[model samples]
Target: MGTATLLLPPRARFGGQRLSQSTARWLGRAHQDNVEGDPVARAFDILPRGWPVAAVTRQRDAGDAAGSAWLRADPVHIRPDINGARLLAHGDALGLTVSDADALLPSLKPLFGDAGFPIDAPVPTRWYLRLPEGAELPVLAGPARALGADLFDYLPDGSQGRRWRALLSEAQVVLHNHPHNAARVAAGRTPVNSLWFWGAGRLPDHVRSNFNEMLGGDDAMQAFAEAAGATAAALPERWRTGEGHRLFDLRHVRDLALLDRDWLSPLLADLRSHELDAGTLEFGDGRRFRLERGQRWRLWRRPIQSFVEQSPAGDAPE
Candidate 1:
């Protein structure tokens, strides 16, 4: 069996704090494709509007933090036809086309044109892994390590306790003042108006559903417990049965302050007093992360592009 790779840009992980060195690594390996435009442009036109989108760009002035922008116009979308025939089995699997590949190609071209990129082409806009129905899971980067995350170290151990781990980490690239998310925060729009990118993976559908339910609720703790139970029920039996070490679900929430361990532990405890769920709370260093039960950010994982320098001289400039 062969493996497929997905390349996503930083804006896909909207709410997380880490955004520089690691994002640079991924962008480094990225390249623009050379192909036709129609099918690829159609794909972009079809993406769900108001979702947090990420892409490497030749243009540094990409606007909109939660709105979509051009990534690349390269025709890499057609390369799978040459590299591997079976790669494009689904609409979601196709790479990018020439018209928009540039939008996603690393922004480094202005500084260094195609000197170190691996494959410069447009392929699919959204990167996903549609594994064979029952194939062995492919090895991929761990979520915490992927997003410059350092929050999973606090999970409680033992039979009655459960662990929550960061499944995927995405960083959102936003302008200093973009209206999409900012307007929503300033009472100009509601949380419902914000767009978010969440960790990528095949997870229980309820995880996302539970999060959406709390998007506009007043009682966050109550919403959190409901979401927690929903997420717990959605987990594979092994995870639910004391065999899991970590789990986390990112969603757009209202308050960032409620994420502190002290705040969450007590609230979680209070909620569980009525329900016998053994939920424990943990926190991440606020400098790089916000742990609120529901914040306007959901963890989204799409294909992220990282370029590998061909030679010492081709390396991206610091």
Candidate 2:
């Protein structure tokens, strides 16, 4: 029998901090296999470039593919406090669209373009600061690294850091003073006040992975699979344990009941009946556990009802 590996977001549904009832029960019966991973690294078994490559793949999907060095300048909401500002919401929380982007970008583009970096948003939620070939810039962390956390700790440092920092500051000022922010505040929406810049590099010649078949991920993950000669696509309506090693991204499942119906219930049944050999569940906190068919017989261990909630740093958007 083949193995199924699943990746779960710690905060799935409107800030949900718990897994499904079926998932919790299975975890209690499963063996504590191993917990190892850098939270920023992709689950794919390749030398992942992290966000830069993901952005390139997305840009390609949007019909604006390019080979230039790329940097993600995605929009983010920064809430200032006594210590420093924290990333309030990003990615899907912004609810950006082509029209919204058209409104906010015209003012910000010339600022970066004048400084030799041109900006583009092929998809409303994803913005790019295209860097020229051989351009020298400091390494920066992606918005994912700074989400819901203090922005100061994730800012770039070193000689070129100041230049990038200055550009970021300038971008914020332009956004803050923009005429649309007033409209946004009046409408009770988060203002488009900041841009997080990271992911800088030329696209690699090839993307590699260990799995031959995969399911459930964004365009970036699918692009990587195609480049690596693997089959990737949407998750099916229900679990059908297939041949070869497989990867499943369960983060997109925002509805708890839907997750249970689509995957959790049947999965537990398969493990109990020994239809599958083994399965693994991994969380954003680098915690991984394995469930085997034989483990269902363990009567002494109590089934877990509630899982340990992840900290702010570990909790991710669903």
Which numbered prediction scores highest in lDDT against the true structure? 2
| lDDT assessment of candidate 1 | 0.24
What are the models' TM-scores? 0.20, 0.78
Per residue, candidate 1 scores C-alpha lDDT tens digits across 276-315 of 1233211121111112222112223221222222212222
TM-score of model 2 relative to the true fold? 0.78
Model 2 C-alpha lDDT per residue in residues 157-202, reported as the tens digit of each score: 7767778878888999999998887788888888888888766665
